[model samples]
Target: MSVEFSVFLIAVAFIGLVVSIIILLRKAMATLDEANKALAEAREAVRDLGSEAGSVLGHANDIAAQVKDKIRAIDAIVNSAQDVGQILHTVTDTARKAVAVLNHTPQAAQPEYVPTNKITIRKTSIDALAKETDRI
Candidate 1:
């Protein structure tokens, strides 16, 4: 081919390559924008979920603290009841010992009969629970 024709053909090919590259670059840019928007929406959703999860955890912690406080109060009450039971046990033991030392016998108590209109009268009496021990 002649030199001018060869130069003109090369120039046309170079221009066509540049136009194709520009079109590809524009499509790439549009895809990148869409991807960026999707990422932003996902980030916002994750942030909202994290805040709600934190709030739920805080409420659970508060409930656990309240349960601990109630358990402590119940423990104190149980300890006081045990102390009272110990004191009563000691007093009853001391009284029984004193009665034996003095040789004082307790009289047998008769169960009182209360008249009732009910047809099913109980045959058992709970007033005298122990056997007679040297009645005075």
Candidate 2:
């Protein structure tokens, strides 16, 4: 073969190799672009989640503060109720002691009995009522 012809063939082969490398580089660049897009989407999702979490935390904090205030109010109410109960107990005890002191002397005659209601018991119906209750 002539020298010029061989040189030209070598040059063509080198050009073909360079073209293949450029195509491969283009494909690599496309893949990198897709990865970058996915990364951007992930970052956006993370940012959205962070904001949502922050809002949720803020709401929880508000609710917690309200709950604490309610608990304090309830505690104050309970303490006042206890104080009232203690005062009532003291009054009741003093009334009982006063009554006991007034009744120090025993009376010879008993007081008359007062009946509010009259109850009648039937022997026949009692057994039947007990049997019915047992069946239930």
Candidate 3:
């Protein structure tokens, strides 16, 4: 081939290669833009999910604190009840001792009643009077 014709053909091939590269670069840029938009949407969704998780954790912490407070209050109530029970036991013991002293007998040696002849006669008369009153 002549030098000028060969040079022209090489120039044409170079231009075509440049055009093809430009078209490929443009398509790559469009694909990159789509990927960037998807990435941005994913980041926003993650942010929303993080915010929702934070709110849920805050509510759970509040409930845990309330449960702890309630448990402490119940513990205080149980301790107070035990103290009252101890005081009641002391009072009961004191009352029992006082009754034992008033009775003036050993705890195991309580006296039994023995009716005399006079007491028996009075009881029989009272019973007869109650029967007559019931009839009336």
Best by lDDT: 3
**What does candidate 3 score in Cα RMSD to the true structure?**
13.1
Reference-based TM-score of each model: 0.63, 0.69, 0.65
lDDT of 2: 0.76
Best by TM-score: 2
The lDDT per prediction is 0.70, 0.76, 0.76
Rank candidates, TM-score, best first: 2, 3, 1
Off by over 4 Å in 1: 103-136
Q: Tell me how far the alpha carbon of residue 2 in candidate 1 is from the true structure, in angstroms, after superposition.
A: 2.7
The sequence of per-residue lDDT tens digits that candidate 3 reaches over residues 1-136 is 6899999999999999999999999999999999999999999999999999999999999999999999999999999999999877766565555445434645327654646543222353445445544543
Candidate 1: deviation at residue 116, Å?
28
Candidate 1 accuracy as lDDT: 0.70
- Model 2: per-residue lDDT, tens digit, 72-107? 999999999999999777665655554444345244
